[model samples]
Target: MPVPLIWLIAALALAGAEVLTGDLFLLMLSGGALAAAASSWLLALPVWVDGLVFLLVSVLLLVGVRPAIKRRMQSGKGLLDPAKALEGKSALVLDRVARHEGQVKLDGEIWTARPHVETDVYEAGDQVTVVHIDGATAVVAKIV
Candidate 1:
């Protein structure tokens, strides 16, 4: 019945949904709602002010804090291994790579591959290096 209690309940529900979905968005809203509940309790704010505070805090947490957290989590993770370095990592061609058909290989295990250039075709059993990975396919250049 009380505004503070309603905000608290909404916050808990959002947090519970976040746990179930494993998405970070709901958690941000939960934080905002909790802030609103606190404001309601501390200042005895009107319902509209509580709602406004919730919206502002939710946007701030999602847009500001979420990105910072994501950056910290992703930081220091390079796209490629330093040892492999895209220069000389060996791969075996498992399929004929045409301009559009692409290639396949066992890069540790079987993987779909694509040649770097349409002009550079490769047959099965051809040794290649992993120049880059594009989506599900490995873009390869001919070895030797």
Candidate 2:
């Protein structure tokens, strides 16, 4: 029946839902609920005030602190790139890429590739650059 207990329960429930759905929103709300519960216990605030505090704190944590923490932890590196990645670099066509089937060699590995433009055709040993990646196929363009 205590406000803190209720808030704690709500927080736990929100966190559990986040785990299930994998959405960041509910997880932020959970942090807010926990903050409200803490405010209730530490400040001995009324139930309504506790609820308001939870809302405020949750919003602050989700909007303000969470992004800062995420940025701080970020290494500016993508998950797929190990050494030089296929995002903004160049590669060479090892074999002629036909209408729907082609292969390229990049970073010493042969990868299935495709031309970005539908009409563009590439020949073997031509210099190509990785433009974009679609699933297993890397979209490539002729490097001048």
Scored against the true structure, residue 1 in model 1 reaches a CA lDDT of 90
- 47-126: candidate 2 lDDT, tens digit per residue: 88987988898888888977876786585755665433676678888888766989998877888998989788999988
Model 1: runs farther than 4 Å from truth?
76-144
Using lDDT as the measure, the top candidate is 2
User: Cα lDDT of all candidates, in order?
Assistant: 0.82, 0.84
Give per-residue CA lDDT, model 1, range 47-107, as digits (tens): 9999999999999999999888877867966666543454356787777876777556543
- Pairs of residues clashing in candidate 1: none
Provide the lDDT at 131 for model 2. Answer: 86
Cα-based lDDT at residue 138, candidate 2? 81
> Which window of 10 residues has the lowest lDDT sum in candidate 1?
79-88
Highest TM-score, which number? 1
Tell me each candidate's TM-score: 0.52, 0.50
